[model samples]
Target: MSADTQMLSEFVFIYTPLPTKEAAEEMAEALVAGRLAVCVNIYPGVTSVYEWKGAVQKEAEVVAFIKTTRKLAPDAIAAARLRHPYEVPAFLVLPIESGNEDYVAWARGQAKA
Candidate 1:
């Protein structure tokens, strides 16, 4: 990729799951309010199956996709963890490898490290 492409790729989408829609909304608002994320999209009615404490667990969850710049990712994660109710909240930071340049620029501008 060219330098320009790299510059445009300096963003990430953080995936975080919460037990309820309310929790997801709260986290989303907190991140946006704190300027850690440009926007957060919340999706409810997700069924998650995983292992915890040597037992399998299944539960419904709401997922949040947080959009922000790479520079603000760490801060966003920290803020999410502080407010997340889960003992070990699941956080997956997916790099924005490519996208509309305008959206990338706008998201980066909205996020503050």
Candidate 2:
């Protein structure tokens, strides 16, 4: 809330998978159109490797980089949850240190924060 604040915001990266790419595309559209996010980069064909229950696991996932303000985080999470096929989607938020003024403005404004 200052002239030098530089429009602080958060970008939430969500990892999910669907039976069809259509579902993924639909999710990306819904979030951006609803203004829950300024932009959503939906990356398909991601192979993820991780540990689960003390065992290693690997799978395909689509990563969605959702850009928005901090205030809209809840709404963004909800939207992703509603559309994601996973019982528990990977929702990780990255705080933006600084960015272009116009882009940051749009992101923060869209977030509804």
Candidate 3:
């Protein structure tokens, strides 16, 4: 892997769906305050379609994009599980391969391993 890739491998984007914008905002605030995430961007008005309890369901939800280091991912996930209302909340983590150097550095600095 390249230097940038290696550097970014330590970073991740965690996507979590909440029942409401208020829930998303609350979780985001907690994650950031606890230093579990460098940043959390809440996107409201998201439509989610999935299978649950052996049935397909569609609902309006809010998605939170949580940015953090891989080292802190577990804590971030744990926090989400505790705060999320759904019995089976969506907690997906995506590896960040590369990004702007300044932003990456800032993120790394903000989210210490």
Candidate 4:
């Protein structure tokens, strides 16, 4: 079977903003270790501008792109929340509509328990 046939709509990308690179790395390791995610790409130097508590807020943060399957999305999200420091964290689960067949299959295999 093709990668699409094997894992289409089965993968997801969880986007989360962390206070620092250390936190992002820690969460990434936890997710991979728990098998909740296959891989997590961390990007630092993110400038976030948002409104919180009825006021605008701006801060520098790191972004983590967690790769996992739909089956583990909930667990992964919950796990991430536990490690998050913010009062309200953003765990955006975005679907992988399409991707490299091999890469997709590999991620799917590694992410599955």
Candidate 5:
């Protein structure tokens, strides 16, 4: 889909990893309260392996699955970035091509509010 088409689509899932569970929870609460996302699911005990500053690194993290409509993805991303501890946080947004219609509608309604 085109970028605009994707942005106007019904669903988008934002993935971000925080340094700690508490940080993840705080960010999730702030995003939901600000209406940037409908729900933020935190999965702790995540082991992340990546390269940083020309060196391979491994670290423990809490991954946040932020559920929201495409219309609110940008705002959700911005909110996450502001609260993220990493210098360059992982703010990945994936489009949901298909899902339960009612749930999608509910998510959209939640984000819109």
Candidate 6:
């Protein structure tokens, strides 16, 4: 199916944090280059605390908000895994049931499904 005509099942927003902006962009670029994701927005200065090895740790990370079609979720996640620094990265996908139709269309259109 043509990428445009390809029906985007729904929207999914994937998120993961990086230690640095460069690293964050690297993951984004890789996904976009491979057509796994359409866009990724990086936000700095996020504090994260989680349990690791039965201990609580805190760190500052650059959060990457990835926008992509549902069909590309697996590829997008795989791309992130390849670029993520942490052995266990915080990758979460949130389905977008409702959003601006036009904007969603543009987002889906931007991706080469």
Could you estimate the TM-score for every candidate? 0.90, 0.75, 0.91, 0.91, 0.86, 0.85
Residues 3-92, model 6: lDDT tens digits: 333433467889888899999999999998888888899999998898889999998889999988887888889879988998888889
Q: Each candidate: what lDDT? A: 0.87, 0.70, 0.88, 0.90, 0.85, 0.83
Task: Kindly indicate the candidate among 2 and 4 with the higher TM-score.
Answer: 4
**Highest lDDT model number:** 4
Clash number for each model: 0, 0, 0, 0, 0, 0
Candidate 2 vs. truth: CA RMSD? Answer: 3.1
Residue pairs in collision within model 3: none
Query: Please, what are the lDDT tens digits per residue for candidate 5 over residues 1-113?
Result: 86445544767889999899999999999999998888999999999999999999999998999988777888888888888888988888888777665776677677865
Sort by lDDT, best first: what order?
A: 4, 3, 1, 5, 6, 2
Worst lDDT window (10 residues) for model 1?
2-11
Q: lDDT at 49 for candidate 1?
A: 97
Best candidate (score: TM-score): 3
The CA-based lDDT of model 5 is what?
0.85
Question: What is the alpha-carbon lDDT of model 3 when measured against the actual structure?
Answer: 0.88
Q: Indicate the TM-score of model 1.
A: 0.90
- Give per-residue CA lDDT, model 2, range 26-73, as digits (tens): 888998888887887777787878887799988876677777766677
At residue 107, what lDDT does model 4 achieve? 77
Model 6 clashing residue pairs (backbone): none
Query: How well does candidate 3 match the true structure in TM-score terms?
Result: 0.91
Where model 2 places Cα greater than 4 Å from the true spot, the runs are 1-4, 9-20, 53-55, 108-113
Question: Relative to the unseen true structure, what is the C-alpha lDDT of residue 50 in candidate 6, on a scale of 0 to 100?
Answer: 86
**Per-prediction RMSD in angstroms?**
1.8, 3.1, 1.4, 1.8, 3.5, 4.2
Ten-residue stretch with the least lDDT total in model 2:
6-15
